[model samples]
Target: MTERKYAIYDSETSGPRPRYDQIFQLAGILTDDSFAQVDQLNIRARRLPYVLPGPKALEVTNIDPYSLDSPEHYSPYEFAVEVHETFQRWAPAVFLGYNSIDFDEEIVRQMFWSNLLHPYITNTKGSMRADLLIMMRAYSACQPGAFVIPKNDEGKDSFRLEHIAPANGFENMQAHDALGDIYATAFMAKVCQQASPELWEHLLKLCQPRGCDEILSAPTCKLVTHFGVSETHLVTRLASNPTNPKQVCVFDLSVDPTPYLNLSARQIAERMRTDFRILRTVKTNSQPVLFHEGDKLAPEVTAEVTSGESNARLMAINDHPTFKIRVAEALSIRASEFEAAPHLEAKIYDGFPSRDDERLMREFHEAASWPQRKDIVARLQDSRMKQLGVRILMSEAPQVFDPAYRDKVKRGMLENRLMPPAEADLPWETFASARAGLAQVDDPELRARIETWLDEQEAAAQAVLAA
Candidate 1:
């Protein structure tokens, strides 16, 4: 048989914002060099206290509110350390995954970084080797005659790596669980390798794109420049031009030279209210009727149109045909600007994801410690040392020495903000005993000393949470 190839990895994160969220769960199944399963990995990582999971994140995890399981229950960083040190057992000759590019890889890489390990540093040359989503989007043809293939841009049936595996006859158990994620990726990899060998072979050469550059675009980056998400949809790159159905009405006076006759720019803008109609098309909601200064009648003309708002300057018109004509012309010009936007360059294809799934795996390798996250570690260290110093000062318990915040010495919250899964997993009542025990020390110096240790413990716990 051909040399065994590929470790299939999978991950479930707190949300889209990887750096800010936690890697709560992970799964991996190592296959031979040929994408055949050989070994496995599964884990539930601790979360950080500051992680305010978004609605989507919350829905996906459906976290057990009744249970209290914080980083105090386990150590993700220590786990990463162990995993990196023993990479041979689970790592396949080659690695693969479904949507691993953004979700799985990122969760793991960040997990390692948060844990203070460099096992899978992202953005570094030669650090990781995959990004399969791009391959499918660029090379594979979508299911024919499908109207509105879900989550896919034009030229793609569906770019979601998670969906491809199951759609193409790969096994799926529990998604978002670490081990399950791994198995799904492995299974999907096998399916893709067999079904689309040409695409698969080409994808193996891609490299990773670190720091959210390749996975998803934001206001700063653009996607429509590459390919239309659908055949009927127009490509959109402007962040301000996204389609939002919730907007009741939009008045963008920003367009040049009004496009309506006998009406002012303001008046035309008021007419575009969506309380009566809302267009799903990109950028059109921001437009209004063309205002032209036709018969330059009194500049105070007002048109009583749709359902109401404050009786104010929002509906007045100047009746200049040039203004209205200019507005229409302005839209034409703006449309052309959007047309000239830069296309997606090949350089953007930094990672060679192996067709949708592996492409995603390659794109999302969580290889680096989050930028500026070291503060978490620093705070832990500082809290420990400062708590100790303060205890030392109070160690002697001067007869008349009164401090500004001395009350905290006994009754203050004992959380080491650094503990992974910042929120204590145990019920608040369970830790009551531990907290009470920690609070009962009478020796001033001993109390101070204990604070330092507590700080360190909290820090380490927080680190675990972060990992």
Candidate 2:
């Protein structure tokens, strides 16, 4: 059998929201299953024309946006392509990172989606995703003695990579730098693996969809989850979503199973809304931290509910097929309640592109000239793809369009950055918001530099509008 490889990565973005923000730097290190590094990558990109860098993000990363515009750096589209192709080459590997499942991974998907590339590359094509932050939470909850967990000022457990990595003997970690964080994450993963090999092995297996399904299939299991603090819930598989099999609802065995047995789907959903302890939705593909029935749990967690009680509740839940169906119905109802996404970038999950549209995406990337690419963009079947293709052309190759149309596109981009809509909730960073973010920066020198950049941007926007 070929040994599995892990691609541990980190990303530094212009802001928090993946839909509107952009990743300026992405770095990764590929290692064998044992965590021995085999290869590495570090790439930076120039900011897209429409993206105004958030002042707070710049303060954290200390990246000068002007510096990224040098000829040596890749354009945003080219950067996305390079990262996508490199990860594809390293396929069948586990894509692991610190808090990546929520933030970095979303940035990657948006980067691909905005550039007219396939968005689910990390979770598809024989690859899987994992988060070190989740792993640390599980470790701290289940086996606190196995490794050191740093405490914040409030004395609560701190899982930030910067705090925990250094506490576990990883030295000189550059917290927000993409490449530095990758090395720190790899170091911490190795520490966990070495400290408790059996637990590390189990958590690593849970990173796979099949492994999560297998563990949750047991009669009763321990689930380690975190919101602000880590918690271990003794839970049993209630039902898998009828529509999405990957989404499984688990019943907390600590609560008596008798009261919930007769409730209708609506009643159960009401109970779920009032108290999540009744039914928790777990995504099997999201690397949930689950342990088999016989696994050792933390002392306090074991005392929450005895094995006998948990098993009895599990038996009761398993015996009630009608209740399971009702819970599944409730899950569907809750899912349907969400409002439709307001923006094109937010509509990434609307549906998959047709095979023909997918083929056109490939052609768009491989086309010889800007005119050819523009023609291919016009032929795309999906509205999202068609719109995104136009954006790519405008950002990267506007020369193909007539001068008037090109100027119109430029003016529109400038207006979105410099002018705020009448609505208070602006999605992307505008000139006003960016300037406001500058007030929070304490370092005089850095604030001055960013202020100068913002002034230049304002001047440039005026010039384009006047043109």
Best by TM-score: 2
TM-scores of all predicted structures: 0.42, 0.94
- Residue-pair clashes per prediction, in order, are 89, 0
- Following a full C-alpha superposition, what root-mean-square deviation does model 2 have from the true structure? 2.1
lDDT at residue 201 of model 1 (Cα atoms): 52
Candidate 1 residue-wise lDDT at 234: 13
Instruction: Report the C-alpha displacement of residue 38, candidate 1, in angstroms.
Output: 1.3
Q: Look at candidate 1 and tell me the lDDT of residue 239.
A: 18
Q: Go through the candidates in order and give the C-alpha RMSD of each one to the true structure.
A: 18.0, 2.1
Q: What is the C-alpha lDDT of each candidate?
A: 0.39, 0.85
lDDT of 1 at 209: 26
Model 2 segments beyond 4 Å from truth? Answer: 296-303, 319-321
Candidate 2 clash pair list: none
